[model samples]
Target: MAIVTSKVAGHAPGQPRGGVVQMARDSWVVARRNLRRMTRIPEIVVFGLMQPVMFVLLFSYVMGGAIKVPGGGYREFLMAGIFTQTVAFAVEGASAGIADDMTKGLVDRFRSLPMARSAVLAGRTLADVVQSAFILLVLAMVALLVGWRVHQGILKALSAFLLLLLLGYAFSWIGALIGLSLRSPEAATSAGLIWLFPLTFLSNAFVPVNTMPGWLQAIAYWNPFSATVQACRKLFGNPGVDGAHAWPMQHPVAASTLWSLLILALFSWLSVRKYRNAVG
Candidate 1:
């Protein structure tokens, strides 16, 4: 009887037990489910990729001539900014996805399951990260077609891409929290992007921070968005005006890393707490 009970419990002698490992496994399962839904709904991926590609063409052709980089061509300088903006804007899709799930009673369904409480939010954010990665890849191809090149070697370019993904992943947590707070997906999408307009445009994403007014330039230099953009510029060896003596612009890689980590840690905690409270 004891042997049968142990076997039924799945407590094999050499197998690892549950806890965080089980939570992660559950999260991956949920992530895969979300990915499958994205695949099934081809428009989601298609439209997501479209916005960035359009921006690349519009900026590279429409504004490319008007904007001047200090030492390099504007097309090369603009790719990092485009990459940063695209990934940062990924928060909209993340928030909308979560809010849609909530409205469809999917959260309630997941709550009824024997799964980790954090898995739902974690999985949603992970799936969004994957989506953002795909968008970045498509945008990169578009940028190359527009004559954007990474002057830095492959290693540095790869590091830049990693940083962009990390920033997007971190921002997705903020979206998760917003989605949990909102009742409808439409509301989440609007609310999610409300601040991002100023956040992305007011930063160095589309223009040189030095071109802005003195006070606005200060704010832009300190903006977390600017930090990542500047970091990518450094990594890709793209030409743009260097940041002033500001700490973030002066040491973009470290600043981007710290900012991303801080945002991820803070928002992940808040999102998980909000999810639990919402479900309860």
Candidate 2:
């Protein structure tokens, strides 16, 4: 009887277990569900894929030729900038999903189940990473067609790709915050575009920051998106904006990564707190 009782206790309901294993199990479920939904939605995939490609092709060929880099053509120098902006913008879809789920009461329904509270948020964010990765691959192919290549060998190239994905995930967290906090999907969508469009365009996405007015230059140089773009340019061995703005480009690979990680950590903390409060 005692031996049988011990076995039953070992498998008792609600018994605490491995944090990582639990997170993994929960994340897998979330990722699978989201991916399945994405696969069924052709329009979402097309738009997400098309926006980046169109921006790169149109801007690089039509407007890029006239905009000269200090030493050479501007098209090659600007690809990294465009990539950063595109990835950052991808966060909008993730934000929309979160807002949609909340508005539809799906999340509230999940709260009534016997699942981990952090699972949905963390898993959905990971799912966004997968989507961002696919977008990056497509963007890379486009860049290659446009004659952009990573001069760095396999290891550095992989690191650069990972950094870009991390940056995307971090921004996704910010999107999550907006999604969770906003009362309506329309408000969330409006706020995201309003906030992100200015942040992306005001930086060196197409033109060099030095060419802008002094105040604009200061803002652009300090912008985290600019830091990320400059870092990726170094990693890909592409020409940065200019010598005058070299300071932002210098050692950007590390600086941008640190900034990305910091922002992600902050957002994660806030999202978790907000979620727990809501649940309580």
Question: Between which residue pairs do clashes occur in model 1?
Answer: none
- Model 1 stretches with alpha carbons more than 4 Å out: 1-18
Deviation (Å) of 31 in candidate 1: 0.3
Clashing pairs in 2: none
The digit string of per-residue lDDT tens for model 1 on 92-203 reads 8789989998999999999877688899988988898999888898888888887888878999999999999999999999999889989699999999989998999888
Model 2, residue 20: displacement in angstroms?
3.4
lDDT of 2 by residue, 1-280 (tens): 5754665554566754648787678768877888888889868777888988998888887888788676556767878887888778756876787788889898788667666677777777888888888888888888888888777776877777888888888988887777788837788877656788889888776787877999888888778888888777777777754445446556677768887999899998898777666641
Top model by lDDT, which number?
A: 1
Cα TM-score per model: 0.92, 0.89
